[model samples]
Structures are given as structure tokens and as C-alpha cells.
Target: MDEKGGAIMLEELAFEIAKAAHAGQTDKAGLDYILHPLQVAAEMTTDEEKAVALLHDIIEDTDMTANELLAQGLPDNVVEAVEALTKKHNQNYAAYLAGVKKNRLATAVKLADLKHNSDLSRLEKITQKDRERAEKYRKAIEYLSK
Candidate 1:
């Protein structure tokens, strides 16, 4: 566990954060929002990606700041990847989504996550526009992952 190149216990952390952030949140299909992050983490193959999965939405939706997350003892790379995926202050939602599409690590998680959300869950609770947005995100995920 103390190996220099080792990945830490990450899946559990990711799932915990997902559960907390998505608490009481249900998709249009009546599924819990926590499932989205879990699905994203499930797609990851590395510890770094797993850590990023756990924290992907924390900064955007919660009170957690990037600096605070950095102070929580996570590796710098994981923090960077998550920050790259996060949408910061921007007036254009489409542009913000476009930015995320260009990040490899974030796009990977986002693709898999959105795929599960829109495909598996059928977006039962989301609006038509939101569904369209999810579709756009899915397409971006595909392009980015490629």
C-alpha cells in the first residue's frame, strides 16, 4: 500500500463521495444520481482515474473547493484531472460542455457516466432539453475517448 507507484484505495472513496453528492437526487427515470458516478468509476482501469471518478462532481455541486481537495492528501494528478473536467465560471453552457470534451481523463469518465445515465436509466426525471444535453455530452465523450 505504501509503494511509490501504487494507487490507493480509490473505488470506495469515489462511491462514498458520489453517494453523498447525489443524495436524494434521482434521474428522470427515477434512478439515484449516485449511480452515475459509480458507473463512471466502474469504467476506469487505474487508481488515478478512480480517484478522479470519486471527485468528478464535488467541486461543481458541493462546497468542496479544489484547494480543499488538494489539501485532503490526494495525488496532484488526480486533482488536476478532476479540475480539468469541472466546469468553472462561464456564460455559455455549451462552451463549458465543450471544454470538458477536450480533456482525456475527464472525458473518459464522463462518456461512460453519461452513457449509463442516458442509456441504462433512460433519464426518467430529466427534461427533454436536459436529455438533449446529455446526448450532446455523450457524443462529446465518444469523440474525446476516441
Candidate 2:
């Protein structure tokens, strides 16, 4: 566990950016935002995984890009984990998903995030369009998991 784990991470500037970027999301399926990453980190049984959860969305969603973070000395692997979880806007989603399935860090983080999102839609209460969008991501996750 990190010396200040939850508190330190949540208070970090980058984490704050992610929090606000996803602020409107409540994960109504009863899973708390914090719990989602905690579960992913728990899957690896490591402190960094937990911390990674707090940061997975930082780069992709915030103004603080991955290069900037690396320059700040956040460590290569940590930066990799966050990047692994990020959605690539320009690349082929199919190829990206394929790449993730073969590597544990990217695969694990993506699956954990996907699984958490999937579990929340149990009742499946959303607009058809929204459901369709979620289904695409779900299919991608399922394909990667296999």
C-alpha cells in the first residue's frame, strides 16, 4: 500500500482532473467510482494497481498528457498502466483491443474497467442508443477476454 494510498492519490492534481472529467458519472449500478479501480488493483494484489486505477483516466481525459507526466518522474510502468487503460482515439479499435489481450497490464486494466462497467449495467436501464454504444465496448472487451 502507498504511504498515503487513497488520500494521497485522490488529492493529487492529476487525479482531480480525472475525477472532474468523469464527474457526471455515478455508476448507478451501485459500484462507486473509487471501488472500480480498487477492484482492478486488488485483482493484481498490489498497491500500484490501486494507484493506477486512480490515474488510468488522467492522461486520456485531462490536459496533462502522458509525456508531461513522465517528465515529472511518475515512473515508466505507472505511466504505461495509465496509458494502457486509455482509449486510443485515432488507432483501429480492433487492433488496439487485440494488443491489450496479449499483455497483462493493459489487458488486466482494460478488463477490470470493462468488467466494472459491465456489472453496473445489470438491469440495463439506459436509452437504446446508449445501450448500443455500451454494447460495442462490451463486445470489444469480451473479444479481448477470450
Candidate 3:
């Protein structure tokens, strides 16, 4: 297979892993969890960025680890971007978002994630936790845009 073919295959594998990891899960709005990543990936401008977006929540929400992502043959840059997007358990949201902003590709993927996550209409169905998250995303956007 050619280089492009390999990238396409890697991307397919990322989608499969993400889909399975998020299976049976639903967003706060009661939508499939996979929909969130897919939406974020759709807004990306590059294949690598899309792959990072797809796997953004994998390490955070699933049993998958960063080493597993590297073993999957994803490029180092993609793995790094995904890692930046994954929030650590005890990390402050602002600090995490600031780190993401340091990487251009990660920033783009994160902005897409924030855009979907902070959608105004979804506020109607959001819980207190979701409201707080939305506010965090809003503040992060402001910080990143500066």
C-alpha cells in the first residue's frame, strides 16, 4: 500500500476504535457519544487533524492509553495532538485549554470540540455540570483567541 493508503487505513482504525469505545454512551443532549467526535472531525481541515479529533476523547473516556495509540501506527504528531486534547483527571480546564492552544492542529481540533460542546441550544437540556463546562469552553475560547 502507498503512503496515502496507509493514512486512510489508520484513519479507519481510529474511527473504529473511537466508535467502539464510545458505544452505548450518550452526550448530555442524549445524542450518541460518537456523534460528538464525528462532528468535531468533520470540522477539521486535514486528515491528521480529523484523526486527532476522532480519538480526542478515547484516552480520557475509555480504557485506551497513549501508548496504545502509538502502537496503532498513528504518527507521533497525531498522537501528540490527541494527547493534548485529552484532559487529565485533576487538571484545571483553563490550563488544559492553554496547553492545547500551544499546538496549532490541536487548537483547531479543540476549537471544533468546544464549538459543538458550547452550542447555545443544547443549554436548554444541560445540567449544572454541563453549564459549567460550557462556561469553561467559552472562557477557553476567549483565552485562545487572544
Instruction: Give the TM-scores of the predictions, in the order they appear.
Output: 0.72, 0.64, 0.86
| Residue pairs with clashing backbones, model 2 | none
| Candidate 1 structure quality by residue, lDDT tens digits, 2-96 | 36666546555555555776688765566776666666787889877777886788787777777876675666777777887777776475576
Tell me the tens digit of each residue's lDDT in model 2 across 1-146: 25755444422544444465556544555544544554555565445555566667666655768887677555677677677767688978887777666656667677777766665355456667667767877997778778
Ranked candidates, highest lDDT first: 3, 1, 2
Best by TM-score: 3
In the order shown, the candidates' Cα RMSDs to the true structure are 4.0, 4.9, 2.7
Please list the residue runs of candidate 1 whose C-alpha ends up more than 4 Å from where it truly belongs after superposition.
1-8, 21-25, 91-98, 125-127
User: Which residue segments of model 3 deviate by more than 4 Å?
Assistant: 1-7, 123-130
Task: For candidate 3, write residues 66-103 as lDDT tens digits.
Answer: 89888877889988988988889899877898789889
lDDT of 1: 0.69
lDDT of 2: 0.63
| Model 1 clashing-pair count | 8
